[model samples]
Target chain A: MTDTTARIPKLTRKGQATRDRILQAAVELIAERGVVGTSTEDVRKAARVSGSQIYHYFDSKQALIRAVITRQADAEPVPGRPMMGALDCFDALRAWADAAIQRQEENGCRGECSLGSLAGELGAADEDSRQDLSNGFLRWQGLLEQSLRAMRDRGDLRPDADLGELSLALLTALQGGTLLTQTMRDIRPLRAALNAALSYIHSFAADQR
Target chain B: MTDTTARIPKLTRKGQATRDRILQAAVELIAERGVVGTSTEDVRKAARVSGSQIYHYFDSKQALIRAVITRQADAEPVPGRPMMGALDCFDALRAWADAAIQRQEENGCRGECSLGSLAGELGAADEDSRQDLSNGFLRWQGLLEQSLRAMRDRGDLRPDADLGELSLALLTALQGGTLLTQTMRDIRPLRAALNAALSYIHSFAADQR
Candidate 1:
């Protein structure tokens, strides 16, 4: 058989830069115009790359979408959380929620979270995209579940409370609340929802001294 | 000014049928391909109508999108108690959740949600569509809040609990959980999340038995 390796082109540093530019432009365009509204030409122009260059980097629009999914999946809300495992109390949970909401709001909900938007826009057509989204959610849920388990072990939460279920509820509430806040272009409702959810969380934890 | 009312074409019986066919096709296409993937030509083929016929009913693609949003806004999950004002207790609240989730599942979580898809797809380009989606969400929240308030009045929930806040949490959980379920293409996670939220609700309510 012919050497299959010969067909694969390796990206040089400059070629990689071009790819990054294309992806960055795509992210912005997707945020502003949505997956359907965004066109390849728009991305090509936005990235300042020629039409040929775009094709060189991505095989198809679907390939570009996969890139977007991977890029967003790797993104985090903040730089540091190395000690996330150390946060084992209800107070820690409340603080985390505050910080998360603040960062999301400061962004003005304009970035249009990649996973959230994907879930809304491409939930039906791309199974691979769906799996990527599922993995992202599961990753987040696992983090929360780990934190909750620590809290339970520390007697911060009720010993019998189902951490998996609790984690899912909290995650779901946060995502849904964000969607509502974005749609209304207001944060008051989100604040109310978060505080209410926090109160529920508190009730499950051991009483504060 | 000349009377312009007569100039507006009224849809005849056959025309109405064609319009409905177009709308139905549009809904299915949008749900599958998102707003970006759907085209007038695509819709024409799905509806088995000529391209000119589509223009006759809708002036442009944006007009068609507006019609879709309006149609979705008017579509509500039935079989629930009339608003939150009439909900007297926890049983009424549970019934509402059941109906909401049932309808959501029956719809197969198509395209995350028609209104949500529109909101995510249109972004800042369509202010009116955004407003429509925002209004629909608010109306939904209002209905839930009214139900929670009735529960509080009936002493079914803690007197100190904020009905408005709780309602927001409930709605957020439902929306987020449904979206997550859609993305995963599995109902177990959604069921778990909802059951957890419901359990939390029960914990907050005053003991009836």
Candidate 2:
């Protein structure tokens, strides 16, 4: 068995809870202060763990960041719906956008977006972080692509439309809009941008009909 | 006159050079270590300035950051090409993109984009910085809109296409692609994304008779 599996077998319920708490604290702190700004001490205080305990759980700060990225990837909503691959229409896509915006607002744009922050900071720092971030983005793009392909297959979109290109466009629009909204601390620009892009999506459907 | 303008009038040539040195050092450090990670001591060492001299030029770290932002913005490429805005063609647009990418690459994506970094970091912390960033983006977008309008008038692009929307789309794509490119430390993805976007733009061009 791998080291991870070996460790997993030894982790008690309490140990598991402590690990979860550490990961949660890391996420929140990294989001608020950014990767470079947040120190190990800050994570310790946030998690209410001692310094030794933190090191015990993870070998280094980079390892902790890796864990956070993994957690974020696991948390991503399945394409087309909250549950796995259920909804598959324009409305489903719209609903997903709405939920995403609401979640960002609730967070007050304080936390660096996990994937974006990781991509921005560590992806360039080291090979491991680069691969981690790239994989995360690929998975994200994959999720979106899955949804687009489903919509296309169902005749909700033009069959001839390039699904890969459309998926990239959608992800780019969403990400770009989020960056603007976060910096401006206003939802209007994001709403306008998304609405404009969605209108384009609608046009594709209309043309098909 | 504002306090800054009033004080600037009294600076000796030597003092001006010193100030320039400080700003240059701050920009380099910020690019290397990021805004939050860089320290006043680091700036002083990089500039070969004593702590007292550093303080003489700027009151605080925040002040130093603001100066760097102003200087970087001033140094950015002039918005309109020469000859009474006569440079209006696909070649001109491509030239602009090439210049932008070159400048960004030279800096190694070190600090957040000067404007983007300020907008992301201080846009919420201070009103003046917010205005500076917001105005910078607005001006950038305005320049693009003007170019798009010219292209439309020349029968290069579809007359019915929304210039404002298209301008925003182009700017957002460039910004988003830069962010990803810098973080990944690989320009290949950015090249792919940009090419895809440009192809889309080309598809909107007026067809030959």
Candidate 3:
């Protein structure tokens, strides 16, 4: 999102792996303590990498954060979680919601959606980060829209359904519900928000035979 | 919420006014920056108060932050913002949603819900702050539920409607929508989320004669 490709240095496979390991550590730290609370030193220690190693991979903390945002935008890059991308049918959408709630429950509702949390902290704090985050959100919305549009094309939803609004509504519910879930330490808010959004989507479902 | 009354020192009317002034300044700083970014020194300079004067009212920076959270919970205490209370009817709920969107538009979607932004930053970071924020959210949700329950008793909503879930849905929409609005710098996500939630609520409205 930040034209980081031009600045990215070519790396050997080992170097790439090391870079990913550092990025993963940074993501975890950022998840535990927000962007402001996390530092490159912390990431280095967590990654068990040397200072030079981190510097070799990332030019600055802001650049590293941008890379993290790009990683988050790529997909649900978190290793164990189910991919939240597919939404070709109603059941897939429902499964996506259930998986989100289950993941929160599994974590004891301690953390939030990584990208959403970063957006919350960095959205207004930095200009470059804001653009990166805006792109992340749009990419996410685009995924949902893609799926919803496919559903409409397949005659699963009404021809008149507005894919953009519906996708944005779903994304907002997830973002809002996840934020509340983090605070309340309860999964119900997330559950209710997603349920409401799903029902709204269903309201546009083509009448069944 | 913290049993702070016993520890609170008695203040003269003047002292109370001064404390409010400091708090107002702190809120502005926190809204602009964040909890992690705003420091006591910043608040002191912003409020034009001496260090001792700030300490006289708030024991520490964390104490001051807790006070800010308290103020946010006291019914949308931000100056000049429309009171987001009195949701005893559908139109009032719609007005609340519109006011939230209008405020975001006015501010160019820079800041999030004050309580929500605090929750975003503090929810997982500090246990005490998490408790304080959980109470803030519950209090806000309670107000919404109070109004929805009133509507139910008056037969405006169906007797079978789950007021708690409905109210939670509405709050989730606001929190989610507001967070997205802050990131996307657009009002449609907030508007769409609230509209969808309101439509869900209206689906439960009592049948017309």
Worst 10 contiguous positions by lDDT, candidate 3 chain B: B77-86
What does candidate 2's lDDT look like per residue over B18-112, in tens digits?
99898888877665556666788999999999999999988898778767766655444323343213336777766666655565677664334
| TM-score (chain B) of candidate 3 | 0.92
DockQ of 1: 0.47
lDDT of 3 by residue, B9-70 (tens): 68678887798899889989888877777889999999999989999888899899888887
RMSD of each: 5.4, 5.0, 2.4
TM-score (C-alpha) between model 3 and the true structure = 0.93
**10 residues in a row with least lDDT, candidate 2 chain A:** A77-86
Tell me the number of clashing residue pairs for each predicted model.
3, 2, 1
TM-score of predicted model 2?
0.75
Q: What is candidate 1's TM-score for chain B alone?
A: 0.74
Candidate 1's C-alpha lDDT?
Answer: 0.70
Q: Is candidate 2 or candidate 3 better by TM-score?
A: 3
Instruction: Look at candidate 2 and tell me the lDDT of residue B91.
Output: 78
- Among these predictions, the greatest TM-score belongs to 3
Compare candidates 1 and 3 on lDDT and give the better one.
3
Candidate 3 global lDDT: 0.82
